[model samples]
Target: MKPVRIKRRFSLGLGGFTYLFVTSFIGLGAISSQTNLLFWTFGLMVGGMIVSAIYSTAMMMSLRITRVLPDHGAVDEPLLIRYELTNRKRMIPAFGLVISELDGDDEYLRGKPHGWVLHCGPRATLQAQTVGWPTRRGAVHFNRICITTTFPFGILSKSIVVTQPGRVLIYPKMYRLRRKALWDIHSRDMIGSRNSNEGGGSEEFYGLREYRSGDSMRHIDWRHSARAGKLVCRDMTRLTPPKLMLLLDVRHRGAWPYDTAERALSFVASLVVQAYMEGFDVGLAVAGTPCPTFTPHHGRIHRTRILHALGELDFKTDEPGSWSTHRARDVNWMVIHAGEIDELFGPPGAHHLSDAELDQWKLNHDGKSSRVNLVTRPRRGVLIADFSEGVS
Candidate 1:
């Protein structure tokens, strides 16, 4: 475990101020009227306030918080961030502990996210979870964790600010790809039906050879062995899934560059998931950005690598360059560009999708109808870097 830097802060809450005001008024009355009962009540109220403040301070000071966050998240999905809260003191039990994020990307989040714990006994650790809905793609930074409490009485509140900076890569917004959209790709190649030269599964027969000592008994051919007077084994071929190579061009081609680029990214993201579900080896290459080339492969790790690279793309650092059209044989290439598609680079028969055709390929969140139009509504000459800075 790394060392956590904590800063303690004390605050007089609204209830504290109200209680103090009423107690002061009663103290004044007791002094003016010289009533023993009123004086006792005033003293008791003051004592209670002091005790509440002390209890709250002690409880807050004896607490420790550690954040357990995921490295990646998807847009519109619940990002469950957890925290481990431990009561350090032997006797002071913490209650009503509220852990919140401070100086983070709150605009990208759906609501004011916070974790709560009803009670954490002394010398005990408890885990609390909070959910955050990310609105868009990119990196979300968490600067600090604030643990506050107004325990025992709501008179005073105390907080401990822990400087635990972290980041989560937010993948582009994904949607269900309609079956019609897949039919178009299926027509291009016999997906997942091709046989590879590797010998493994029983899908296709590769050849026959002498049976090895450790060969499976089911693979031995009895008729061939009897004729040859030696044990023979069948070598079966493994089926190779089809491949999808996505070329994402996010260069500034028109007025609404940022929105157009975002839409193209989301479309590619959805297609990546769809292709993986259909058993296609997927690869992604981003134009103008400094992202590295991703080769066509099929696996959960490969898919995550592509998505992470997409999330880290920044137009501000993009260079002026043409799209790489290093076409691989048998790999179905799909060029997805933002705005105009005039400068796209691919084979003549390669699939192409521009801003106009994005909504057609995407399905709604509930998997019902076509996606709503995501075209930006006239942001005249707004630079992509400026727009991203404003959003963050």
Candidate 2:
């Protein structure tokens, strides 16, 4: 835990001084005039000011602060930062404990519009909650905390500065890929030579045939060959699909801004999940100041990596020229875009398309690559939903 230094605003101190000055002047005038009523009024004003100062100081001194932050949140999601203020002194009731966070580049700096107030009993602990909505992805650090009180009398205001350091990582939204698009990649036509021979060597032995020139010596059945009076090699074959490298273009391409780039990030996340379930070695990349690369893997580790990356995605406007530079040569490439597939696939090569054009192309051809298929499809219906209803 770090130390929270206390400082009173100069304006507040000036107000306190002005209050004392006026009371003192009235008290002096009454003493000079020898008026009992004026003297009593002077005494009350002086006493009220003294009591307000002592109580205000005591309220600030007796409070202890702590913060609670969420482990993670998606872009544009509401993140709650709870401020726990414990009242150590029993006599003073804690009220108007305004807990606010200082603003950052992506967040509004004037502080959130609302705060929590608690009227604490003696030795009671009160918690004040402040929420922030992260508009972008990345780490958000809050360097300042303010705890204020106007309790007992509204005339005197007292506040303390709490220098607590905290941060939250805003992630990219996850969106789902179309089932038809996913199925197209997983179809039988996409199978290759390796798919037929992947696990065959480990299975039950099949009868041998004449040894081929390149056949491995380990596969030779000496006893069987001797009995047959001929050299023979084991026959084995198993089906396996070609590994695919799915690259998602999360960059905004045109005039139509689609509810922030976060939506595209969500769609990328959904595609990664779908690809993993279908047994594809998936890698993820995004366009930005520093693009991210997730090495291809399968199973739970891959899922976790992909989701984690998505959670931290930030939008970048700069384009990466073409998919050729980003994609791995041996692995099949699938580009997931949020706009028209044809325009998005600019100067395409071996990439499978998942936009609208790909869908239309599939109708004419039997999923075979005449020209590399570019599927163009609309953004997921669920992704286009009104997040505003919940955001504000």
Give the clash count for each candidate: 0, 19
Q: Which candidate number would show the highest TM-score if scored against the true structure?
A: 1
lDDT of 2 by residue, 163-251 (tens): 77777666664443344454554442352214343334535555577887878888888988999998877876554445556566644
Best by lDDT: 1
Q: What overall lDDT goes with each candidate model? A: 0.76, 0.59
Off by over 4 Å in 2: 8-35, 90-93, 106-114, 121-127, 174-245, 250-263, 273-282, 287-289, 296-304, 307-333, 337-392
Whole-structure CA lDDT of model 2: 0.59
The residue-by-residue lDDT of candidate 1 on 70-121, one tens digit each, is 8789999999998888899999888888889886686677775787899999
